[model samples]
Target: MTQAQQLREAILAAPLETSNFGETPQPGTLYLPLSHLKALRLDAHVVVGGRGVGKSFWTAALQSEPLRRLLGLAASELKGMEVHAGFSIAEHIDNYPNADVFDAFLAEGGDPYDLWRAVVLRWIARQAGKIIPHDSWPHTVAWLKQNPEDVARLMQQPRNWKGLILFDALDRTSADWRRMDSIVQGLLRTTLWLKAYPGLYAKVFLRDDQAERTVFNFTDASKLTATKAELKWARHDLHGLLWQRLINAPDTHGEILRDICRSTQQENVWHVAPEMKSESDPQRKAFETLAGPWMGRDKRRGVPYTWSVSHLSDGRGQTSPRSFLAAIRQAAEDSLERYPSHEYALHYESIKRGIQKASEIRVQEMAEDYPWVPKTLAVLSGMNVPMDFDIVREKWENAPAGALEGNPTRLPAQHIDRGWDGVREDLQRLGLLETKKDGRIDMPDLYRVGFGLGRKGGVKPKG
Candidate 1:
């Protein structure tokens, strides 16, 4: 077989799926970006990121002793530290409260600060093989509030170990914005209080919107805010991640890829290292070997390496590594099926189809995190972006307001309470929509393609 045939077969077999990272990340497959190092610090209390940006990935990684030790190579602070989950998407009723328990606690006029303290006390009790009120939240809160000195004494008891408590999927604690904010605020207050005792720390993973809300209303919220880090991906970071996955492909593909992109051996694991200062240069060349230099037949259509990422960016100019990888995977699959005899493994048209696939995946994720967004956006399908704001409002007005049909009524849709203007602002904040310089509203291709919106000259779905 020719080299093109081998590359095509290899591309078809490359392991490019990112959905598992959102669920339970495989430690062996993780690509720790340089920017994420700050987030791994023990002192970095708050980790803010958009959906699919490795919040859950880190939450799982930190829980595993072996993984944490491996990660310590990148961030030396993690070595020898004890880690525990304060709360996670995977339910652990004994360790933390769920949505029902939180609602009951609030309904009884319980203080969030005191309630969170009770959670910490439970962990302490478990360590000492002692029992506290586990049957009732109110009883637990009463015990914690009534015996502050006892709690302090228990926490102060010297231990030979240092521990880090991680909290992710806090969104599962409550659906209501106000209630979730209160619970998070209380948790943050408790995290701050934990600092009084050495060797104990709290690391929270929060959505970008959740971090910007009223969770910091109380005094000294800045203590945690000051050390906050966002899980952002740069252009190079995204390309870097692509190569990291590429080199790990099955033997037929991996051997050829290992030659083109150089790697370093550390702890017997092969890590793809940057070959040039630009970083983009090596990444571009690696991709060119598969898709060629231009997106189409010539340069006017743009370079595949740059065009793929730029087009996938959200309204805020952030591109998710999830979407980037998904598009490339889809592009390769499409090329193998539709353009089998082409010179390149990935065709320009196939790349456009890949964006469509990524947009669809993004929409599904948005529905899971912000259910009401689809309720509002589905009405605007086929509408061109950068249109007058008033025109956009009229579309929403005509659209059905079934925002609460399947969601909890108490938990408002991310910003549905603020009306159309509020929803628009929230969308822009989440990078789903943008306000162009001329005051018209525009949708990024990432969201636009999936939501069925169109631009004068843009990729359209296969129907």
Candidate 2:
């Protein structure tokens, strides 16, 4: 076996992990894209992004002291700063209430605003070595509502306690759109309430849809909105993240990848250079060594460097590090099995297969986020896209009504009653589909291949 084969095996074996729901990402897994710098600062109160874009990843990362120190490399304010989660992916009943508690609290005619303030009052009390109500969520909330003076004293009780409180996975707050909106709005209002105290801050990680709603309807909400940051990944950022994981691969694979990347060992882990973090010649040249220049026989076939990221993009033209890395790992496996003697670690054809794998994963994510998505998209699975909306509408109309049935708790199409146009709008908002310039509907390969849709001269869905 040659070094290229070894590289293929190495790439095949790379951990390449993405969001593990709520697990703390390894220190070596830290690759702070320059774009995310503002999102991690102690001051940014509201961070928004679509799925697979590091919303949860950052939530878990900021919880670890070591990871926070690593993040301090980009944002100096994070070093040694205390951190806590008001709400997160992980369940910590002692720290905050879970979805069921929230549902029950609201079901009993509780205002979300009072419930959230109760959550903060408890955190402040615990830090100050003072006891507050904790028998149940409603119990604490009752204490908060009943004793305004004590709550005020606890909130203002001057202490050296200074830190950032994070709230994430807000979708779990409630399944119903209206209630979820109120709950999120309540949290934001609570965050705004926290703004009065110096040195105490709250950061809320919200989904794009959640952030776009009436959650910011409260007075002084602009204070949080003004500091809002978006989590995004550029074409180069995805490649940069891939090499970060590859260079830090264990043992010999790590050494091999580090050599290709010219990575130097730093802080007990391989550090990707500044050049690799951007769309510079060094970054482009590095990927070419693994994937080769052209995606096909020659230049006329298109450049592999640009083609891979472009094809994996969502309807909004965003390429997430999660999807990009998953596709690359699958690509390496395909290249090894099908083209063992190929000049590069990733063959053009194998790259195509990787898209399908990533698409399937993305599709699963969409279904989980919106259970109605799969059935809705399934109505047009066998058809080609970039077609007229009328044609797509006709297909959905003829389908069984049960096809659109959704889980009782999960949200359905925003305009389910408004008909196909509403469903189309929902899909577009979710990055599943887009309207072309000419009003023809199109689906990005990220979703298209997974939904089993065909495209003219485009990557095909798995047979």
Candidate 3:
């Protein structure tokens, strides 16, 4: 076999892992996008980002002592801190309230602030060997609220350790948007409440929409909001993350990647050779080593590095690390299967197919979080975007009542009662849809490709 064939097979065999939802991230795979550095700060109480932008990933990573130590190198303040989970979707249901229980608590006029404090109190109680009402949120809340003086005394009596409690996937706490918002608000309120104590802190991972909503309506919501840090991926960060994973591949694949990648003393800190000046520049060289820079043999088709990322961006020009990795993984699989004899491991066409795959995964994730969004957007799959607002509204208006079920995520029925315009506004707010300067509707490539929508001059994927 030729060197190209060896490279192709190695690429085919390389492990391209994505989705940090349920598993503990390996220390080697933890590439901190510079934007996430703020999130690792002990004082950054609230971290916000869109889906697949490391909310759950950071949540899980912070819990691991090894990862925390590694992370501390960048955020020195995180050193010597104990980490706990106040709430998480990946955690056992018993650890936090489920949907029915949360609703019931709200029905009884129970405040989410009290519920969140109960969660904190339980964590404190566990540390102090004081057993509280662990079985019931109501009982726990009542106990925590009734014993404010005791709770204050207990908090003040803390030992030699400083600690951080993490909250992630707040959407799981309730299906109704209002309820979830309230729960998140309460959690933030609790975060502020914890601030009075010197050694204790809370970190919340919230969705962008959740952070932008009325969840921060309280008097000092600004305190938590002031410390908010966004989890964004720069173009260079995505490339750095890709090489980091590629060089860490197992066996012969790892050997080949390490030979090409420049390394730091840290076990998996992979980078292009020192000749590459910028973070984005190394990515181009590293990717060129695999796919020879261009999408094809010529420049007209596009550069894989630019085209791949440009095609995955949301309406706001944000491209997530998850989608970028997914696209590359799918590109490799497609190239090996369809263009085994191609000069590079990944074919340009294969990369386009990868975008489609990434889009599908993104869409599915969106549906899981906002269940009604897919059905709502399905009405316009084949229609070209930048079309008139009235045209889009007509499509939504003509959509059947059964087709318009908007409560799948159990968000409040605010949109269900409102008309198509309201739905349009909500989609825009979520960064799924945007209005062009021409007063027409536009969906971002992050969402458009999976929905089977097409752009006039965009890279087209084969069916």
lDDT of 2 by residue, 396-458 (tens): 889986886878888767767778888898888878889988989999999999999999899
The C-alpha lDDT values of all candidates are: 0.81, 0.87, 0.78
> What pairs collide in candidate 1?
176-411
Q: How many residue pairs clash per model?
A: 1, 0, 2
Winner of 1 and 3 under lDDT: 1
- Compare candidates 2 and 3 on lDDT and give the better one: 2
Backbone clash tally for model 1?
1
How should the candidates be ordered by lDDT, best one leading? 2, 1, 3
411-445: candidate 3 lDDT, tens digit per residue: 63335557777787788877789998888888887
> How high is each candidate's TM-score?
0.94, 0.98, 0.94
Candidate 1 per-residue C-alpha lDDT over 424-451 given as tens digits, one digit per residue, 9 for 90 to 100:
8888999998998899999999999999
CA shift of 428, model 2, Å:
1.1
Best by lDDT: 2
TM-score of model 2 vs. true structure: 0.98
